[model samples]
Target: MREVAIVAFGQSDHVRDSAQTSEVEMLMPVLHDVLRRTGLRTRDIGFTCSGSSDYLAGRAFSFTMALDGVGAWPPISESHVETDGAWALYEAWVKLLTGEADTALVYAYGKSSPGDLREVLTRQLDPYYLAPLWPDSVALAALQAQALIDAGRTDEAELAAIADRDRTAAAAHPHAQRRGPRPAGEYVVAPLRTGDCPPIGDGAAAVILAAGDTARRLAAAQGRRPAWIRGLDHRIEAHSLGVRDLTDSPSTRLAAERAGVFRRPVDTAELHAPFTSQEVVLRDALALDDTVRINPSGGAQAANPVMATGLIRLGEAADRIQRGDSDRALAHATSGPCLQQNLVAVLEGEA
Candidate 1:
């Protein structure tokens, strides 16, 4: 098997609204930034992949338009996923593993401002059972929170603390949308307050992947350490909410084990837990103790860009490893309700 690593990572300044900027426009700058970081150009990329949602962009095949920024005019080896960018990154990693590409570019973006994000996300539910009912994302998350509380796993006050701590930690994160300490505010749902939820935002993020010698060369040229991916895996739970336990995430635990999370202690973890209560569930699933630093970049609670949020978690973890802030790290991304789908990757700097 070929070794792969993240050589570069960059993201746009996440904002509550980016209505003025088109998706292509928002992506162009980020693409330029990441390529410049590694001294590479669009033409140098071996493969390119992206992630986005048509529902959020209010159009079919919206990801095609975003490709304009990459200048695919000459044609490029590319693909896309209609979900979060983290999944797209997963695809690119596999591409590298096959030795089909020496360098791969992966990016994801989302603009949740124009539509009713809550209702739009409901489209992901089962059409026969849940789609028609139209339960908003927050309400669905609230149901999970209440379950955790009833199970004596966590309570409202602890959820509030998670919210406050994460957003506050984002104070120094340049691309973060929500920062500083704020009131937990009123309950949007019975067990969840305003701060307990992630801010609706528009944002983009990009990462560069290289395999084996190519990975080392890219990082060496930039005088930076490479964040090597030791293991990666994803798992999904039953789609029917009634069939699974909301207070626990067996899928997460399974993915973590497959990704080598339990093999050794990771000093840092970037979790894509959009809701405070979900963070509690992930903490237990990943078996993280207080010794581990969780979400130093604020995770999704600080700036949740939906499609791009998961990718950002991986990028933040890799960046920390590259910067010598951590020796090994755990990065997790999720899709669907109540952590139904989970992806985990264990990254480490050369020891």
Candidate 2:
């Protein structure tokens, strides 16, 4: 298999509203920033992929307009996933492996504040049973939290601690929406609290991937270190809540093992734990220890723009490697209720 490395990454500042800008407008700066970092233009990319949901925007083909952000005048080879952006990254990586495209551009975005996010998420559940109940995302996560508490995997204080640390970390991130000190007290559900939930926000992110000599050239031009993607894989689990175990993410376990997450000690890890309780599930499923630095980017708990959040995790992990801060890292992304579907990517700095 051919090797692929992330040469550059960029994102828009996470915000609550973009009254003056469309999604394409929001993505233009990010796309330009990524291209500037690599000294490459849109025409230089061999392939382009995006992740987004039409349902989130209450419209179809929301990604079509966002293509303007990539300057599609000459038209570029592209694809999109209705799933999270991490899946789009997976598709792009596969395209690289085919020995076709030497470089690829991957991005994702969502303006989740446009609708009642809680009610919108209900559509993700089983239409006949769960959807009819209108089970919102936070409610499903709360169920997982209760199960974790019952299994003694976490307590109120642990959830608070995760929220505190993640918020503190977000303070350093210029694009992070939920930063600053959050009082770790009380519960929004029972174990989860208002402080623990991720902020609903709007944002876009882009990453450039290159292989072999092209990758080396781009890395040199950017004056940035490359984070080589060692292995990447994703898996999905049964969606039925009654039949599935909410306490552990079997999909994550499967994807991590496939991605070789345990091959070596990860200097840092970026897990996409949307809610505080999901953190426990991902931690156990990925087998990350205390030595692993988790969510240094504040993860989804800081600002989750739906389809974009997971891919942002990958970009954040790559950023750590590019900055000479990490030698080995793991980036994770999850979708579906209670972490039903998961993706894991193992990354390391190239010599």
Instruction: Give the number of the best model, judged by lDDT.
Output: 1
lDDT of 2: 0.88
lDDT of 2 at 324: 85
Task: Please report the candidate that would top TM-score against the real structure.
Answer: 1
Off by over 4 Å in 1: none
lDDT tens readout by residue for model 2, 266-315: 98999898998889889899888899999999888678988989999999
The residue pairs in collision within model 1 are none
Question: Local distance difference test, per candidate?
Answer: 0.93, 0.88
What are the per-residue Cα lDDT tens digits for candidate 1 across 194-242? 9888999999999999998888888888888899999999999987999
Q: Which pairs of residues collide in candidate 2?
A: none
Q: What local lDDT does model 1 show for residue 143?
A: 96
Using all chains and alpha carbons, the TM-scores for the candidates as numbered come to 0.99, 0.98
